[model samples]
Target chain A: MSRALLRSVLELRPAVPRPIASPRILPATQIRALQTQTPRQFNPTAQFVDPQPRPSQLPEQSTSSLSSSSQREPPKQKPNPPRVRLPTTPPEITPQKLDPSVKSLLPLLAAQPAHYITIHIHGRPYLVTEGDAVRLPFLMPDVQPGDVLRLNRASTLGSRDFTLKGSPWVDERLFECRAVVTGTEQEPVRVMIKKKRRCRRKKHVFSQHRYTTLTISEVKVVTEVPEDA
Target chain B: MTIRGLPQISTGRNGVGAFILQCKRLDFHYCDWAGSSRGMNGFIKSLLPKFAAAHPQIEITVSPRPRKHPVVVGHYVNGKTKSIEVKNMEPMQVLQKVKLLRDASGEKDKRTTKPVTSINESVRGIWSPYHGNGMRV
Candidate 1:
């Protein structure tokens, strides 16, 4: 009894959802008996039973009662699952805001002249700045027709004049970023000529890649944050 | 029409002090420039005493600007940096200049001071407008 009590205490907390099932712990016979009785008041203990422990569903009290009640009534051999209140949807939490002092650092870092904005695109940081023409290691997609993105996130903001480096990331909230999207730029066509020594078989492949060009318009450090903001 | 930017003077006494320099920006109708020197003298003489009584600090000095848009200039302290932004100008011009100056000052704060958003709320229009875009006349 002490061991059973210890087990019950250890396994008492119900895990994710299905709360009604956790309360009812009767044998299959008792569960069917409860379901069949039309005039009986709803007692959750008369359903959901298993010899092995299934703590997520039924607590120990009803399981004990199931053994006692089964001797008196010869119940049907069917499992009656406890009532489950199906959740319409799960709860969602909004993103939390960073502390203000931390939030203000990003803009100051960006304001450095000739700043290199190292933006992590697909888990890889690409170092870039205004008027930077670049070729990507891989192609990016789902952009068309004058799509302008302000590449605000940066790991470093620096210039020939000065460089204020961030340990890892600069806060996006601290600065105003504006970048113009110049449509995809491409590498010059490459010609590969292949020749075989004996068979007189030759193969040639040509390839070229295009990359998006961006112009950093202005990175203004904001100090007078909007009051309502 | 009272001009500001009278230099702040150390009272030597600490808490209470008086400003050093005196300047005023006064706007009044200019009927004609063709008037004789004696006629202009009459106009200055007519206007001087009332203005003197109203604003004792200023001794009016007049000259016509090319476009006749009146402006006032003076000096003031900003953040940890000693810099000059147009202290006074046409309302629109002051607003524009203050914006550029605030940007510069914010940059200075980044270099020498704490990262909190520097706010000199006294400078109107130079301040970023709130999201709701509201003000009282």
Candidate 2:
């Protein structure tokens, strides 16, 4: 019964009153001032206020004194020392011409199907072919993954039919040999036990070392000579 | 002591391990009736056989080009050709020119100002303004 009475009361209530229209006329300047003042009241902190004192705020006499002092002082001159130029690396010595016999036989050797090369890196010899994975004795410094290193020094470049041997080191411009740095690999931990002869003192030392891994990406006898070649 | 082995592959440099001659073919063009062909005919008859025997890698062809000056055209592996006129020249002079062509790398002759030409990075890195202390006045 009370719910029915509440519903009937709510239905009997009059609709909300619309805003009443005031016929008061304000001047254009007054309306503009009101519009401008509304935003300032809405956000009081919106305008930026610089913390430092502006030049305009200084007294004219002080400003003139400051300007006069600045004019009186000579400009600071920086003495540029002459740049020290370092000597660049010397150019590679041009190689001697090929022997007549070797020149005649080169094409026959190049016509072979497959070839292998013995390359030297840091005075270590590595007999490798294309797509071979090589593990160097020591970690290669200053090299990152995906870095391509050109193997310039080779002792022998040969195939089943022919072999081209170099005296001590081969010329670097003969072949196109590339190695891609794969990543660094870590070895298993090695533990060494140390003990004193007289005393019962014992110590265990554990060690693990990392090595850079590389893959022989390409090894091709450059048949076509490039512009610089 | 931990034993670690780094993986590395051999890099091949052309002319380092072995040099492939750039001049693949030499074409000798001579005129039969022209007086300029006199020395060229002598070179073809006397010196060409020895030259061909010395450089088996290079293919040699002799063709008669009527009314034209005798020219030795060197076909390079880089798809460029260098032609030298051997008109009225001695056989030895023609051989010298042939050697020059044989040794040529097939690129246009360029004046290289720098002494060293390399693909490798500079040993001393570039100077940067952001690094090192600034000079005070």
Candidate 3:
């Protein structure tokens, strides 16, 4: 069948090169290149690096001392942008010194089975527990589905017996809260009618908005306090 | 004799364990002899192949609907279908619409006032004046 033949042809074709890291961290020019270059779209700047390096490339570069040598140095290795990986260990932040009363009552707060946190994103507070769904008002850019976001800014963390209220914002080191980016949701299209008193023409304007959806995956309150704190 | 109900503890939440795209399939319909399907035909010839290859998870099918405007129908895992009429639009514009359909969650649109919704009971139990120690005002 023609479909099988097409599949075979597709299988024989070379795979597209994937970037070493996320495209978001790239410079503005490179990010623009990535955003503009769709599949099969013609882009003069997009070039593929040779997978294997040639043995004589070094000697060829050194021997060719022509005026335009700098322009034609080598195409084997494109300068890969430096990648930033997620931190493996907890980062050092401003430590909080717990009062004697808070230290004693903290055990009782941690003893309770359930806890809740009011996390803030973009200065908006969301009171959520684990397994809750949150649809942010604005579309979150540079995040894909299933990406886990750490909710560090919080005003309150509470349990059955106790509540820790922050003065504007809480210490990020005290608890861990994470949310997974679910897909996006769109509102129905709004059509507005516009007309002028003298003119008979009527204009209809259409607009639709999208919001990013997220689900709280994990919410854990650290039970033990560090010796220094 | 005493009867008991089934014990169910947990509910399924998407993106909690593993995330699956809501759009399951995309059906593109075009007419061979219609003038309105000019852009749709061009898209089917040049762009759809690349789009289909990029998203192997979504099942794509192109069929002919004679003497009618071109339409793009999206089928979701939630057992809902959304169809958009793409008559007289350019191929790039149609591509944008296709991306819109692919990203949608397939739920009916509603104006949401609250940011968070949770089913879990409140962590702090309701306080009653009579139960706790009496306080002097």
Candidate 4:
């Protein structure tokens, strides 16, 4: 009877070991599951799991989330329209002669040290000297880095000694003005809380505008016949 | 609230605010003994001085071109020179030529087909075949 009692004690000891082993293994598995889930949420390369179904319907969902949120706003802000491609065709320009009296004075004007030009783009005037960096009011459509733009329409080209003014616009062939597109600049995001009277709902409107940046690469008076001539 | 100011510089329109004369100088060349320079010599002595005084901006020079016909050359700011033969012409005719040269822009004359020319983009954008409703056959 004592031998039977000893065997029963051994069996009871095995049951205790089993319960201890399970507790240790279970904690390790739970920790591993948590680690995997955390990475999935934070990893940029991980597959995107839609938290809400509405956003996934938009066309630009494949890219990063910043552009996706911009799309959800009102139609007034169209998804940054596809950049318009500038035509490769050259502008039609005709060389013009100055009145003899005006022509005679050009040498003295050109001899003056520095000059400034008032160039017009899209009917807006920008008075600048060479090497001036201008932040345009609107994003230039279809322009890219290193693209050279010839500014032909000008109101005036002047120096301290003399000013040459145009009736409406100075002949483009009279002056050689060029601008190089450096890149684009973005303004800081602005958040506006829109609240209606007698209503509890508050909508957050976010906007970030972008502008084209350009540098006045050159401004020179055309004293000689144009190369094309 | 949506409006934002864009920093831009005003562009210069050459003749919009002020006009600069393009003709910088005039040189009168005449032969003292040549019969062809008789009227030109008289004009230089009489009408030329008043014309020079009228246009202070223009630098005028009178020099003898030995044995050659009388000529007036206009120096333009465009690095071009226009010469007019005033041999045997009256002072009035020489004055007209001077006015013509002074008004010239120094560019070759071109036949303009369009009634009006502008740098502005067209208000109506170009039509694209890929866009808008497809034309029915």
Candidate 5:
């Protein structure tokens, strides 16, 4: 009876390897049945599993539940993409009414071909037409090659037949002028020798200045004027 | 028989229709053994790949020049070339030099007093005493 009790205790322990088969270990099959009835405590490959549900959709405890429950749920659809935004120039404030003479002659000027404009930059005037190249006296900062610059300040806009001269400055609504930054150019280096009378020492100073280059892309005069003007 | 040239009716101007970059190619030469080329070697290994990828139009070539200082040469579409010595320069400084070369117009430097240069004829005809209604003297 003591030997039978020892065999029952050995069957109760689950650590016994399954490969060992003996007539005394007939209770091992009963132990296998008990193991199949219990749920899995942990999964070693759970971290490497693909198609896992998003963390926001399920809690950690719910994720550990039976895999069959997850298969019964429907697949989630992807969210819609955001709309694209395009860059545009900001609109200017409400423009003032054009002078009666300007209103009448602007159409005539616009009809003529090959126009030129006197564009002012930093209070300096530069008379340029389309396809002309201008090298600014000072280095223009924060500008890159291929950038289009809209020149708004102008003192004069004229064609072959008619000329529109502004009173100090022209209204920007009448015409459009655009230029593209090409590159920068430097002047030849200059050397100035400083000397004093009866002094054996002389100092040499070298100076070079860089200038920004731009090509006039467009010089157009609007033909239509507001009826209210 | 007299030889004559073709009469040109139009001039070809850049940026009038399509814009083309002046810089076409860049050559980087570095000395592996010299201490002066240490920064250049680093720039070639680290920064050059990204720069070449960014400017696909510019053809870039890198090669070693033993026992000499590092030099960069830029070839332009106008058939002019500019070279800059980058010995003892940091990577960023060398990058700035390269940008300067890329932006150049490939023309010889000269002092210019006028801002605007145009080939187009003036909108208002030139003044002449021989033409138009005679002005009151």
Candidate 6:
């Protein structure tokens, strides 16, 4: 608040009081009073309580007049604690290595939301949406071509239009996205070996990447959601 | 087309069409801003375009996971992949890490290996979105 407005408010100066705007003055005064009482918790400056007329209403006379008027009308009380409408969380989905409790519920709660999970490969998070084509960074181990696979375990889940977000760990029970694995796509095998000549020690690192393609078929939310996404 | 120091959070159609690449049974190691150009962003930014170019029929978009969490926060692109993680490694080095994870969890079975337990009273805590403020997510 400017010093001029402070002086006017302290003096109870009624400036530009429109008929449609007079009622709002009461609530704004209440808010200001609350702010004065607890400046530490709340900001005492002008809040957007009334948007019609953006003028200060404090009188320019003396605070003594404002004090007498306040006395005439009994002091108003503030509202109690406000009810919060925060998002509710799914049950614990983390592994409690020491407690063992989190581990037990992990199977039941964490996987409840999704049947197929998009896994990240090569520093990339894959959609693995139903009917997705995935090429592994390297040849997969012991997997043949035309093999059916399901990718489960994802950090995120959402539809093209709608989305249900989980904190780093999205609630698993909220959704179920599944995919069918296709056959392997293999690159030519390559060899990279290291050896120490004097000791006759040769280490052979043979590499051949085989990736499995998946067809994601389903991605759906369990319950009805309001507009918020 | 590109994601920089900020997570490219989009529900745009291009990010979610058909064919999402997925890696299942993965133990998520990082969930910070997924597309922030610092580490993984540059890599994935390069990777997604190539895939889209090759498969012109399929539309592709990469966006952050719904709710932001440390354990799972990453990108969700089309029906293809859930995330791309560099972890401060080179492109090839990054590829090697993903390949290892894919090989380990190649089996189709995705059932959770964990057992069942109850929510104890002491553990009963609500997740407040804004530090125990108004929102809960």
Per-model C-alpha lDDT, please?
Answer: 0.36, 0.56, 0.68, 0.58, 0.68, 0.35
List model 1 lDDT by residue over A1-229, tens digit each: 5555444433432221122122322221101112221122334442334453343333433323222211322223237554443212223323345556544654554454444455544455655544443333443332221223445455655444344454565545445454433234444576797987887888888876544333344455555554433
Instruction: Supply DockQ values for each candidate.
Output: 0.01, 0.01, 0.34, 0.01, 0.23, 0.02
Docking class of 3: acceptable
Model 4 alpha-carbon drift over 4 Å, by segment: A1-95, A225-229, B1-137
Give candidate 2 regions above 4 Å deviation. Answer: A1-91, A224-229, B1-137
What is candidate 4's CA lDDT for residue B14?
Answer: 25
Q: Write the per-residue lDDT of candidate 3 for residues A10-52, one digit (tens) a residue.
A: 4222321211111332111111112311223332222224343
Candidate whose DockQ is highest: 3
Q: Poorest 10 consecutive residues of model 6 chain B by lDDT?
A: B115-124
The alpha-carbon lDDT assigned to residue A216 of candidate 6 equals 46
- Evaluate residue A117 in candidate 6 and report its C-alpha lDDT on the 0 to 100 scale: 41
On the 0 to 100 scale, the lDDT of residue B61 in model 4 is 94
lDDT of 1 by residue, B70-132 (tens): 332322222232223322222223322222222221212211111112111221123455744
For model 3 chain A, where is the 10-residue window of minimal lDDT? A25-34
Q: For model 6, state the Cα shift of residue A141 in Å.
A: 5.7
Location of the lowest summed lDDT over 10 successive residues in candidate 3 chain B: B90-99
Better of 2 and 4 by lDDT: 4
Q: Evaluated against the true chain A, what TM-score does chain A of model 2 have?
A: 0.56
lDDT of 5 by residue, A1-229 (tens): 5554344333222211110111111111101111121122333233234254332223222212211111222344356532222222335546778888888888889988889999887778999999999999987643445556678778999998788998877887788887777788989999999999999999999999889888887899977656765
Model 6 CAPRI rating = incorrect
Give, for candidate 4 chain B, the lowest lDDT window spanning 10 residues: B114-123
The TM-score values for the models, in the order shown, are 0.30, 0.37, 0.66, 0.38, 0.71, 0.25
Q: Model 3 over residues B40-101: C-alpha lDDT tens digits? A: 89778866887787777899999999999999999999999989999987665577678678
